[model samples]
Target: MSAAFEIFLQGTPGLEEALAEEARATGFAKAEAVPGGATLQGQWTTVWRANLKLRGAGAVLARIGGFPASHLSQLDKRSRAFPWGDVLRPGVPVKVEMSTSAKSKIYHAGAAQERIERALSESFGATIDPEATVVLKTRIQRDYVQFSVDTSGESLHKRGHKPAVGKAPMRETLAALFLRQAGFTGEEPVLDPMCGSGTFLIEAGEMAAGLWPGRDRRFAFEDLATFKPDLYARIRSEAPQPRPLEELPGLFGSDRNAGAIEMAGRNAEAAGLGGAVTLAHRAVSDLERPAGPPGLVIVNPPYGARIGDRKQLFSLYGRLGAVLKERFGGWRAAIVTSDGGLARATGLPILPPGPPVAHGGLTVKLYQTAALR
Candidate 1:
């Protein structure tokens, strides 16, 4: 339908720069970071490719249209006049959500939402549903009404293949970006000594084996009127064949809990990545570097707010640091923690902190290390 439009790739708060870099590296055109997300300038096909290829984006929004609304009456009139058939088909259900700024005359978000819904229903014969999979996001800022369609139904972190998870599993999108920040390039081994559900290990293995992150999922864009199913299939089919397990370097993980290790194994197997991602049940104290070229060791251990008590975690962090310092030479390390004191307890010469990333309401920072002395 439309030739070209602005594509918004939503990212975590502090990781917008990482998402922008990922967008550019993945061949997106004119990719740049914005406050809440990254923008890519491209056609309809590019939107589809972004949904399928970009690993760091939480959701992709195709900004369809916008207009300056002097008032509610003008907003309704202009919304009806817009060509809704180009993107939204008749009988397709859409849920409208609107946000208004303090400077706008039409200050009620509910009023704007209802007006747009009525226009889509009465004028375009489209169904309006509060529980629809297709979400129409609208923003009213400084009296300007901007509209965008949520091309991604669920967050990209789902990945569609991991049915099992340990407590507080790290999202795949965040894990991918964190791996990049740790300087991983699929050429080195990755070890998650305190791995829970084995997110970091599996994601690293998938990247190394050339597996596409979105192969197992369906996107909301497929339901759009402008969606070209055949073209989308072609884009998905362009992904490379996964490398054999033996050819991939070690992507290893181990947990103290047997149940966690089992669940992580099952999740990796479901993702068709069991061969490249190896999981075992063990404690952080017993962690030994895999026998090969040195690589990056990244882990997300429990913090004070969840899983373990604050006073008792100091020894756990201390043990993890001591083991790494004693056993792993020529290997780099990265630790993520919401508490700076916990990070310091690692005693591994933590590098300068990266920006604080929001993780489940807690702000966590990634502290990395150079090759061990």
Candidate 2:
């Protein structure tokens, strides 16, 4: 068993605490929200579980070892002495990346990367690849350097299931966090009226079914030397079967574009949620409250879109508010948009927007509304 180490869960700027809540809910040990991300101490298996169970983490890093080095030669010596065999393999290709602050003695990132590369090459017999599956990251702040391994090969948002995507697609990680922010657990139904590519519906459906987001993806940890095949096999095999679609609450989505509706279905099928989610082509004004009970309405609409005329969206927001007020009574709504003016245009009594989130070069905020009358 690998020793317990600090595992960092990278989250979106404004949504770090939400990811920490998810980590705590998923039973990660010592999960705490940090400035840029979340951190927890865990063994190797915990790393695997974080990749599998954490829906809100953008990336996961495993803290290796590092030392204080004032110069390149000292860095090389210390890095070579570091036990690369403990976590990383000898032959596995790696990419060394470093970020040095102005307060650090090693001011040149390139020079620091070169020293780390040489250490890996001489001691670990590892080849450096620009596009390697394993990433070795170094963070130098005020002469203190911490080395970490990117345990998530790609961003956690790239679940490797959805090939078809719509314009301004909401990342799966963001969608999951946003769902949590809206107070929707697996028990409640969810609807995304402007469900381009069905991100919200699919994420909700997976949550309701107890599906693992990382089940379909390969993690970088699989390439490490510390990986135990039998232990990992047991872990992977322990994946719980998803609840039958009929047993869960409704997870619905709709879009005006027929193409988006079709693509959404394909994405759902790829995610093993074809039966769990129901996406259709319909405008917001045509949305009907799903029968049985009121749930949550979550939508990510275009606010400062470049392709569409911005003026046309006001009428669209107005119609969305009108439909929800008249038909979707007793349901809560969460809207994400870059423009507060457009959010207010919805005419729903949405609460004041929260901390601005950096998304696609724009700062967006979530506007939450109480249950409609």
Q: How do all models score by TM-score?
A: 0.98, 0.97
Q: Model 2: per-residue lDDT, tens digit, 1-373?
A: 6577899999999988888999999888479999778999988889888998899998899998778988778888898898889888878899988899999888899988998899889887999999999999899888878999999999999988998999888899999999998898899889999999989998999899999999888999999987888998898898888899899899889999999999999999999888878887888878988887889999998775633677988998899989998998899999998888888998999897777877887778889999999
lDDT string for model 1 (61-95, tens) is 98999999968999999999988888886777998
Per-model RMSD to reference: 1.1, 1.3
Clashes of 2: 0
Q: How big is the positional error of residue 215 in model 1, measured in Å on the Cα after superposition?
A: 0.5
In model 2, where is the ten-residue run with the lowest total lDDT?
301-310
Candidates in order have lDDT scores of: 0.89, 0.89
**Alpha-carbon deviation at 342 in model 1, angstroms:** 0.6
51, model 2: CA deviation in Å?
A: 0.6
Error of 2 at 293 (Å): 0.3
Give one clash count per candidate, in the order shown: 0, 0
